[model samples]
Target: MGAHRRKGDGAGTVPVGGGRDRYFDALRALALVRVVTYHAFGWAWAGLVFPSMGIMFALAGTLMARSLERPAVTVLRDRIRRLLPPFWFWGAFVVLAMLVHGWMPGWQIVYWVVPLGDPPGNAWGEQAWEVLWYLRTYLWFVLLSPPLLWLFRRAPVAVLGLSLAPVLVLTFVWQPPDDRFGTGLWDLSTYLCCWLVGFAHREGVLRRLPPVAVALLSVAALGYGGWYALAHQAEYGGYDLDDDPLAQAFWSAGFVTPLMYAKARFGFDLAGLARFRRLDRLVTVFNARAVTVYLWHEIALVLAVPLIDRCWEVPAFEAHLPLESQWFMFGVAWVLIGAFVLLCGWVEDVAARKPPRLVPGARPATPAARMAP
Candidate 1:
C-alpha cells in the first residue's frame, strides 16, 4: 500500500502526499485495465494485450523484499488474507451461475470450491475461471518468496540474471513444444523475474542505470518485442500469439524484466498534466476496487452478454455502431464498468480486510493457503 501520511483537513480532499506510494496504485491500475480490456476485447489490441502483471510481480517483490524484516509467516498470512475470501465467494458464484445458465455439465460443486476448475486442460484454461489464476499464481509466488528472499539477499542482481539464461534456453532455444515444461511452475518464471526486479527497483537499481543506456535497451527490447509481435499476431492468420519464436523472445523473463524496470523507475511524472481532479479521483477509485473488479467483472459480462445480445441492438446513429469492433468494444467496456462498480461497492467492507488474530500463533490464510497466484 506504499507508505502515506494523510495531510490537510477532513473537509478537504485527502492530499496523497508524504511519500505515498501512488506508483503502486498506478501500477495496479495498469494491471486492472490491461486484464479487463484484454478479456473484453481480445482483438482490439491483440498483440499488446500482454498484462502489466510482470510489473505487478516486480511490485510484489519490492513490497515483500522491503518487508523481509517481518517473519516469513506474517508475510504469508497478510498476503493470504488480502487475497482469499473474495476468491472463495466469486469462484463459488461462477459455478452456481454457470449451473443456472446451463453452461456447466453437472452439479459438480467441488470444481469451483477447490480452486481446480481451470486447469491447463480446460477449454480456455485459467481464463475460463477468469481471475482465479492470479489467486493461484500469486499464492505460489508468496510461498516461494521466503526462499527467494534468502537467495535474493545473497546476490539479488546475479540471481535475477541467472533467471534469464534458463528462460531463453527453455522458452526459446530448446523451445519445448508441450505447453507444460519441466516444472508446473514454468509459466510463472517471467512473472517471478518481474517480481524480483521490482525488489531490485526498490533498491534504486534501475534509477542508477544511465538514461541513454536504458533508452538503448528499451529500443532494443522494443525492436525484439515488435518483431515478436509481427511474427505472431493472431489477426494475421495465427490462432494465438504464443507460438511465435520472437513472441517467446519478447515475453522472455530476461526481455521483460529490464523493460519493466525501466518503465517503473523512469516513467516521467507527467500525470500532473491530467486536466481534472475528477480524472485523478477516478483513477484512485479504480485502484481501490481493482481486485473486486478483476474478480467479478467477467461474471458481470456473462450475465449481461446474453440479455444484451438478445434485447439490445445499437442503432446506426449511435457512435461505433453495428455491434462489432469498436462498438462491441464499447459495450463490453460499459458492462465491465458497471460490474466493477457494483462489485466494488459490495465488497469494499471485506475484500482484503482480514480481521486480527483469532488465536495465538495463528493468523489468517497464509502462504499458498488460500491464494492461487
Candidate 2:
C-alpha cells in the first residue's frame, strides 16, 4: 500500500528512510480512531466532523492505483490475500458462535466466504457483523479498478464525472431502490466518486489543478452539501450527512480535497519527534494492525454493552449516572478492542506475509530468495 517505492512518479516519491508516508499513516490512524470512537458512542456530529469512510476509501484507492502497475490479476490476488485471512478468521469465529447458539447452518453461509454482498447474520451476531458492508464494497472497488484505471488514464475528467453521476441521479432525480441488494448497490454508487478521487490523487490530477480552482471546487461542494443537508432535514432526521447520501458524497469530497493537497505539498513531518521512539512504534503498530482493529472493535463494543449495563444496574453507580450516558461504555469498548488486537492481531502479519511482530517498523521487507520452478 505504497509501503514500497516504485521507479517512476517523481512527485510521489517516497521519502528517504524507506518510502513510507508517515502522513498517510497518521491520517489513517486518526481515521481509525474516529471510526471506533464514533461507533462506540453513536456520535452523530462525529460523522460530520470527520468523514472517515470517505477518507479511508480514498486512501485505499491511492494504494490500489499504485499496485496496478503490476498485472491486474497479481494486484487483485495480493489485495484479496491481504484482506480475506483476517476476515475469515473473524467470520469463522462469529459464525461458529452463532451456530452454537442455535443458528441453522444453511447455503447462505457461503456468503461469508467471499462476502461480495452482506452475509446473513443471526440475532446473536447481527450487530457485530453489520460492518462487513464496507469490506464487500471494497472488494467491488478492487475488482473494478483495473478497467477504471484504464479509463481514467484515457479521460480523467470524463471518468470522474461518470463515477459521480449516479450518486446525483440516485439522490436527487430518481428514487433509490429500498431492498437490501439495491441499497448496497446504491451505497457503492455513492462512494465510488471518493474512490475515484484517490485515483486522481495518484495520477497527480489533483496536484495539477490550480490552487484557486481546487479551493473553489471544494467550497462549492461543501456549500451544496450543507444546503442539501438543511433542505432534507425534515425528510431525513437531522443535519447528519450520513442520512443523505448525496450530501455525504459532496461533503466527503470537500473534506478530503484539502488534506490531499497538503499531503502532496508539505507532507507529514516526524523530524520533531526524533526522540519519541515509543510513539513512533505505537503508530507503526496501529497502521500495521489496522485491519485487525477494524474487524474486531465492533465485536468488542457488543461484548462491552453487557458489562456497561451491569454497571448501570449497580445502585451506587446508577445514582450519579444518567441513563443515557455512554462515556464509561466507550472507555470499556476501547479496552476490549486493545485486548482483541493483542490476542489475534498476528493474523494480519500472516496475511501480509510479514513476520509476526507486535510493532513493525517503517522499513520495507526485502524480497525472499526464490528457487527455480
Q: What is the alpha-carbon lDDT of model 1 when measured against the actual structure? A: 0.52
Expressed as tens digits, the lDDT of each residue in 103-201 for candidate 2 is 996777787999787788787887678777777778888999999899999999888767767888876688755655666667677678788888888
Quick one: best TM-score, which candidate? 2
TM-score of each: 0.70, 0.86
Put down candidate 1 lDDT per residue, 1-373, tens digits, no spaces: 0000000000011112433255455556656666555556555334344435554565566766666668888877876666666566665655554556545454444535433223222343233364555555566777888898788768866876565454456655664544322332444553556667766665566666676765675566556656655655554345233333334334433444565465556663435624555655555656555556766666555555555554345454245344434456457656666655654434433644633221111224876878766
